[model samples]
Target: MAPGARRLATEVVLPVPESGDPVVVELGAGAGVFTGLIQELLGGRGHHLAVEADPRLASSLAARHPRARILNDDASALPQLLAEYGLGAADVVISGLPWAGPDRATQRTTLDCVRRVLAPQGAFTAFGYAHATRLTSARRFRRMLGSSFEEVIPGRTVWGSMPPAFVYHARRPRPRKSAETIDLLAAQLASRAAAATDMRF
Candidate 1:
């Protein structure tokens, strides 16, 4: 988390729709940085699941926010974890995970899990260093967001932190048939019409 990054995150630009009861999940919530901010914004209206992979940090997070359910698990197990709580998907998933630190495969797997666990209209928000966009992994991660979400929007760059960082917010991809499948169906329909015409002739 950056200096003003937490404030930037809580701002409306991130676009977390406040339904009557919205379910929010925070990944890599080490030391309760974003977790505190998220709790304040949630205003005790809904469930907040704070997931920290480290046992020590998870314990501390649980202590700090007793209302939040702290999960000592990996990001890849999000689907199973949500099932335990009788949730099909989360309304919002905020990630504090270090994208640049993980290997490319690990990053991809974690992102895939996030996408799988997000509701149809849910949003996913994460941050990356302002200067890191030139890096291969950062660029690759941005591309991954583009493919996964219907809309990928970047927020203001917070330059007050040590290195400065910017927020990347993504919405869930629309559920629909793929372009290839639709094209194949069209071709099949055309072939059937042609065969019918030949038979009539």
Candidate 2:
């Protein structure tokens, strides 16, 4: 495994419990290294959804981790994919997605997808190369998560793995107002404004 990959697996496993299994979703599971750790963490007690974009890797994961449901799909489709499995939400979401080369828009979309699938009180954890921490995309990624999540914390570094990495943990946002709710209120205001405008005319 690559240095970053190894470090990611180790970091991802840190927050998981040894018992009282929790439903987990792993996005961008490259080669099942982290998947293996998650399996060990859960001890075959909870449900795991391993989402990988690569067909070859997904197939390999399905074979190796029979306890996990492997999905050969993009991370952006996480919400719909979880519904297909009859999973309303997950207790935790682990991401090994690469953020080095991606633009800010792509990063934002990825984080939004993660937010959509996270359950109340659930967390989304991911690791990025330590060197890439200064990049604008990385900063924006952290900012966007911070805006939506109640808490955004950085965990310990995994020095054993290559290039080193830091884990980012974020808790789900409390419901102040959902998008649908905001839209409805906006429409009502617009309607009232139009009525007033008509009366003025």
RMSD to true structure for each model, in Å: 10.4, 8.9
- Scored by lDDT, model 1 comes in at 0.78
User: Model 2 shows how many backbone clashes?
Assistant: 1
Off by over 4 Å in 2: 1-8, 174-201
Clashing pairs in model 1, backbone N/Cα/C closer than 3 A: none
Best by lDDT: 2
Number of the top-ranking candidate, with TM-score as the measure: 1
Q: Write the per-residue lDDT of candidate 2 for residues 1-201, one digit (tens) a residue.
A: 776666667767676766776779999988888999898888888789999999999999999999999999998999899899888988889988886567866876777777777888888888877788887567656666666577889887777667778888888754534533543454566568769999998
| Candidate 1 segments whose C-alpha is farther than 4 A from its true place | 1-5, 8-13, 174-201
